[model samples]
Target: MKVEWKGVMPAVTTKFNEDDTLDLIMFAKNIRAQIDAGVHGIVLGGSLGEASTLLAEEKNVLIRETVQLSEGKIPVVMTIAEQATKVAIAAASDAHENGADALMILPPMRYKSTDIETVQYFKDIASSTDLPIMIYNNPVDYKIEVTVDMFEELLELDNITAVKESTRDIINIGRLRNRFGERLSILTGVDPLALESLFMGADGWVAGLVCAFPEETVAIYELAKAGRPKEATEIYRWFLPLLELDISPQLVQNIKLAEVATGIGTETVRKPRLNLSGDERKRVLKVIEEGLKTRPILPDYKSF
Candidate 1:
């Protein structure tokens, strides 16, 4: 299947019951809600989904349920960020078989000596599947960062077609985009820089914030695509504070809270990846409350 990678692809949250099990029902509801709100794409098992916290089977189940819920209307993109190429390859195949439209692979995190294991890991998985792969290059959580040169080399693989650049450096993204041009679909993973990236010529956004605020994120992409920079800028400004929260240590928790606050999804998450508690959550919740008070022109998201 030729998956068109563009527009809003929320790094969706994996809903968990209070007992720490995957909440497939709430998760499917969230996916259906985003699709109804008009997001162009959906990334099932990314960082925001708490990939590290989920078991392999749990992630597999999440992909399967997401594919079932999407029901072929939007593309289902899942992450395979394991350090071992074999694991990554296996997950990619699972995603493909389970109905994912594309796979997003990131550089390995453990044993960061920058060995051939690093580059060849990507090569091994890229060659393992016919599914179109988009490399996710985020430097913060993962120790190894794929450089433009390294990524360009990986592009020699036929299946490697797109990338989700989740760094703050617009200059780096611009440089990569200028060099690769049409050969790569550059999607910014950070919501704060998403608008800037669109203007800088990125093809899409793989965002976590969009899970709760789909209307605003989609609007940002549309207005920018329609050449309405002023309107997009205003929208971006209104959500900038909330966008900052998406990158914090509390991102996964905060997104679910925002979703619950908006009555779209649950705030429940797994124990190892617990939701905010006590004082910290109180302070963070205050930001959401205050942001809600300041009216920003956005879509009226209906309860699903």
Candidate 2:
């Protein structure tokens, strides 16, 4: 399945049992929901999927399961975030062998590498795999920014074809479009900026909140891209609060809780991480509940 690299591709969360084990049944249900809702693709083991806590074998399960469930309906792109180049290469290799169609990768985790090292890191990984890559650039959270100049250097690699642009600077989206033109498929990584980015000519959205509100997320992207700005704005305004959750530190818990509220999945998170609680729990729930209470009737759009 060759990824079109346009439209809504969810950075989906990994569902777990109460024992903190991978719940393949429940996980499959979630993936099915996204595809059924008309998402263009699905991304696994991303930041929202708790890649840091996931074991090596666990990621393989996600990649293989997503591949089987999707059954070529949508491309299943696995994310690779590791500290060492060799480990990232091995992980990328494992994803490819297990049938991932593409990869959404971050710079070397923990230690912030220089621009030269960053470029080399991507080059080495791309050299190892035939799968196309979407460079995950979230400098605000990840600390290392893949500047346009670095991207200029990276353009030497043909397979480094897309970008998960999360710079949080909307101007940079335009910058990328103006700089690279069709050479790069820019997918907005920040949920709150989805509408703005799409309007700014981003090719697609790699979304987080879509885990809980798949249809609404897809609606916003389609409506905007279809040039129905008014209809898209109506939905985007209603979705802004819930979308804000994706940018928070407790994003995993927040999104999972929203999933539970939406009857899609559980709020159970792997340890070192816990479910939302106290005032924060109430606060998040209030936003989700309010949105549900007045859930807008989405305008009709063609299905993928």
Candidate 3:
């Protein structure tokens, strides 16, 4: 399916049972709400989804369930990340077979990785399935830099049609748009940088916080796409802090807390990634309260 690189694409959180099992019921409801909110697409099991902690079967199951709930109303993009080429390919293919519209793959995490190695890892995944591929480069999370040449090479692979540049380097985004021009769709993953990416020639936003406030995120993207930067910037100013919340040390905890606050998904993140404590919890809640009070969900679309 050809995706519209226009509005926001929420990387929907993977809800889990108290026993740390996949909660398909809430996940399906979240998927339905994204569709109702009129988002461009639904990104399942991505960064906000805590893809790292989920088992392969759980990941596969989540994607399959998302496909079923989506009911072809929206494109389903799965974040399939791995250090092994074969495993990444297998994951991408699995996502595609289970009805994912696209597969976003992160660079293979390595101790001392090179651009050549990163490009090859993606190529390995690209050759596996016909799904449109979006490159995920979150240097903060993955701890690797994707050189411009690596991006250029990745673009040569036709299936590699988009990128989720989660780095602070907005210049690299402009460089890619300058070189590749219309060949690829660049989607910003870093929520705060979404405005910068849109201004610099990105086609869309693959937002993590969108799970908490899809309506606002979608509104911002729509305004940006329609060339209303002034209004979009106003919305972004309100969202900047919320975007920064994902980078918090208690990232998963903050994110889940915010989602629960907004009445989206549960605050149940798996272990090894613990929930926030004392001062950290208070700080996170404070940020959420301030963001909500100031922005206030547009007075409508608040029921979600």
Root-mean-square deviation of every model:
2.7, 1.0, 2.7
Q: Residue-wise lDDT of candidate 3 within 1-304, one digit each (tens)?
A: 7865545788777798999898888877777777777787888777544787988888778878877877777788888767688877788777877778888788875554777887778887898777888888778777877766787888778788887887878897888888788787788877767888888888888877877887788777777777778877888899989988866556667777888888878888888787778987888899999998897445232232
lDDT of 2 by residue, 110-200 (tens): 9999999999999999999989999999999889999999999888998899999999999999899899999999999999999999999
The top-ranked prediction according to lDDT is: 2
* Winner by TM-score: 2
Pairwise TM-score winner, candidates 1 and 2: 2
lDDT rank order = 2, 1, 3
Model 3 lDDT-worst window of ten = 295-304
Candidate 2 lands at a TM-score of 0.98
Candidate 1 colliding pairs: none
List pairs with backbone clashes in candidate 2. Answer: none
Query: For residues 1-304, what per-residue lDDT tens digits would candidate 1 score against the true structure?
Result: 5787787888898888777888877888778878887888888777545788888788778877877788888888888877676777888888888778888888775767373666788898888888888888777666567788887788899888888987677887788878888888888988778889999989888887778887888888888887788988998998888888888877888888888877778888776677699998997789788778884876332321
- Provide backbone clash counts, one per model: 0, 0, 0
Q: Counting only residues 3 or more apart in sequence or on different chains, how many pairs clash (N, Cα, C under 3 Å) in candidate 2?
A: 0
